[model samples]
Target: MKKIAIFAKVHDPRCLGVAEELVTWLEARGLEPVVEAHLARHLKFEPGTEPERIPDSADLVVVLGGDGTLISVARLIGERQVPILGVNLGSLGFLTEITLDEMYPALERCIAGNFQVSERMMLKTEVTREGEVISSHQVLNDVVINKGALARIIDLETSVDDYHLTTFKADGLIISSPTGSTGYSLAAAGPIVHPALDCLVITPICPHTLTNRPVVVDAGARISIILRSMNEDVFLTLDGQVGMELKAGDRIMIRRAEHRTRLVISQSKDYFEVLRTKLKWGER
Candidate 1:
């Protein structure tokens, strides 16, 4: 039997019902469903091991929730190269594009090893203080650095590949992967890039100068930013999930990670269909 891992947002009341149905379906088909440990209590069935252990044991992963749940689990499955099928239980989602009615068919395809995988690029961000690396995170979305609500405009000395790019005087800056172009980058008026493209975009939030605009750089280039202002409330955030407070003289470097998130796509679906449904493109 192929070991299939399942994860979900346990807080969502809707997941409990669907999870029970899915577990029974998997069992009847001679498939072993390994559910995340923490969600066992919420789900109406006997589950498998811890969520982190899923990456080690399972051949495939199924995520049942919104984009945030998938991202949180994706962090745990880093570098594993396991194909993930994200089912949308929340509102319209870009990552979790598959719907409830289409779940079983997608799983059947995955089990038969006939699904298409999208190798989406990920970002690696490092925080250095006084030449010492303090923290690092691998994220699927953008790395954002911004000031607190009450703080004044800050200065970030930006560079690409050991060369000085510019010193940005703005509320903040965003370093986004192509997969994240539709996220916070889009909100900052940055361009929407296809996930299949191997590149990154840097956008300035409320930049001091009208000419300082969003810039897209090659994926191989290393983008660095040094906090030039002192005694201010600044932060470095990843995937809009976790974040850390920033200090003056802090240096942040962002680049493409060695591994990418392998997303399982239905054979009947295409990227443009998802974009059109989510964005309501060309509709009157």
Candidate 2:
């Protein structure tokens, strides 16, 4: 609680300003502030810390950007179980819940351990060829398998555990955690799931078949997707941030990761409020 890690999007003027103010406020309160290397250059203070040195070395992380920046920090500190407090600077940030006005209050509660923690489920995805692992990645949002621009429809043969699900003739497939149900999955006609739900959502994007609908599965089940078409070029995207190209005959296995992301939350805020505000639900 005496030392904190601060991460922000240096590209955003709002984030950079708030980050400097936060460092000054923390230092005045006799608390140590650690900022990322790139962010430090834009900061009023001298550059000293790096992303690799934060979270593990500090008690908590204060994210001063939109949900995208927070998600990146979540992935980095997720393994250490360090709590992250996000300050929203982007439009429609479903993950960044705290506002600029609420920053000090949230930080006060966090340092005093007077806050709640939401454990969001993460996905552990592995791409393998001939049973040998080719690439491995973790995602906080959703794992998307889609075709490249100007490419033809890709064939994805999806299966749940031992049961053969179906062959999807579509643009792509999205496997999302309950926390991510409102993201790409929702745009693909997937249902919105509460973060407390311990389930996985399977949504097919632009499916050729009308009967192919979004399906929810137990988090414990593993999903295997085999690339069936050879001519078309497809790729795998993680959290919409990282992507990898896939060739025919590649197998992608997705399941709930053993490690979970711990997000710091204020007790007063509710999930439905966020839904209403972000989605403009029930608004005239």
Candidate 3:
């Protein structure tokens, strides 16, 4: 890749040093490295680009931090389909599967054109209020509809492909992609789906009716939810990052976006190994 973009969680102390070293390494190889304006200042680099503009010209993007940071960059990527190398700076991450020690090796493989990528599905979410589209977002993880701490249990009238599904009476609801099954959905007792699968999971958070369980649907299905509760402190969150308060009668539409996130697979480990390490699977 000629122009490689670097996105990082600048707040993490470890990221600064890693980024500095990475930049130096890229320059030594006669490759161009781009950093965010804010982070470039910390690294003493001249004339850095903005985050939103990084994907416009970057041939590949490298993300440094946890899964949250990777998710943010995924959103920024939108429909670019650029390959991303995610290096975890902290604990084990689902998306940031490559650890700090593996970063250089992964980069070497990438430079040698010997890397593989996993195409992860993304969700397109649209908020419609009073017959007007207010906002739209693309998320790599789950779209959460939740009530405030003091708010009462909200009612979400859900449907699939225009077919009416059950009305979920719960603290919240999570609609996640196969890649997001291990996120909020998992914490809400939803099933863990393999990322290679093309499906969506609908999970309820503390449903009043215990029978309300998580449901998996086809990726082509058009899922929609309408807020049936009034005067409730409810909100819709995208990837746990962007959010907006929901009003009564608002319609939230979700579908598999045409855009997909391309993540560079780590050569050191497989998916099951990652699950075993992250989940502590089989540990007594």
Candidate 4:
């Protein structure tokens, strides 16, 4: 019997209902259903089942909530090299793209060891002040260095592969992976890149000069940003979940992380189908 870790958002009825159903289904099939602590109270689950417990014992991690919840759990199990299946119960989800109807079949394929695993890239971001490394973080999405709401426009000096790129006077900057190209990068007028591509996109937020457009960089290259303004409130955000404050004379670096997130995709689905369904592309 394969041990499966079940995680969901308790606030959503759809997620809660699905979690309960999955627990019963897994148990009937002689599989152990391990749920996250918070979701335990919502379902009629047996005692002594938790996320931490299952990650060590389970064969797979099944996340039934939105992208944010999945991201949280993914980070919790980071570098464990565990495969995760995301079922979307929220809106505009890029990570949690699987539908409710696809749940059981996906699980069945996992149990049968028949599925495709997409190795999505992650980013490692580091912040330095006065040449001293202060903070570091890992993000599956883009790394944004921008100014606060009340702060004035900021100046950022960017470089790719140690080669100086154009400086930007804008609200902020976004450095995103190909998998994250459809996210904030797309909203910032950046091109949408297929997830299979190995590339990084750099987009400026509200550039003062219209000539400064977004640029796509090679994935193997290193990206560096220098905070040129001495009197502005700048900040660094990771996957829009974690953030750090930036000071003048501070330098920020971004590169491909050593670890990757293994996402299980349905054999019947394609990336273009996801784009069309989620984005309503070419629709009147």
Model 2 local distance difference test score: 0.89
Global lDDT scores for all candidate models: 0.89, 0.89, 0.93, 0.85
Find the 10 residues in a row with the least total lDDT in model 3.
1-10
lDDT of 4 by residue, 1-284 (tens): 38888888889998899898999999999998877777887775656466666667767888988888877776666677688899988887777777888989999999999888888888888999998999987777788988988998899999898899988899999999887788888999989898887888999999999998989888888999999988788989888888888899899999988888888886677888888988998899
What lDDT is reached at residue 99 by model 4? 85
Cα deviation at 245, candidate 4, in Å, is 1.7
Q: Using TM-score as the measure, what is the rank order of every candidate, best first? A: 3, 2, 1, 4
lDDT of 3 by residue, 3-51 (tens): 8888888998899889989999999999999888888988889879988
Instruction: State candidate 3's TM-score.
Output: 0.99
Off by over 4 Å in 3: none
* Tens digits of per-residue lDDT for model 1, 1-284: 29988888888889767877888899999999898887776774564588768899989988999888888877788999788899999886889888899999989888887788888999999999999999999999889999999999999999999999999999999999998998899999999999999998999999998899999999999999999998889999899999999999999999999999998875667888888988899999
Tens-place lDDT per residue, model 2, 1-284, is 98888999899888898888889999999999888888888875676587777767888888988888987887778578788888888888788888888889999998898888888999999999888999998888899999999889889999999799999999999999988898899999899999888888999999988899999999999999999989888999998888899989999999999988888875667889999989998989
If scored against the real structure, what TM-score would every candidate get?
0.97, 0.97, 0.99, 0.93
Candidate 2, residue 173: lDDT: 98
As for lDDT, the candidate ahead, 3 or 4, is 3
Q: Locate the minimum summed-lDDT window of 10 residues in model 4.
A: 44-53
Q: Once model 1 is optimally superposed onto the true structure by TM-score, how far is the C-alpha of residue 83 displaced, in angstroms?
A: 0.5
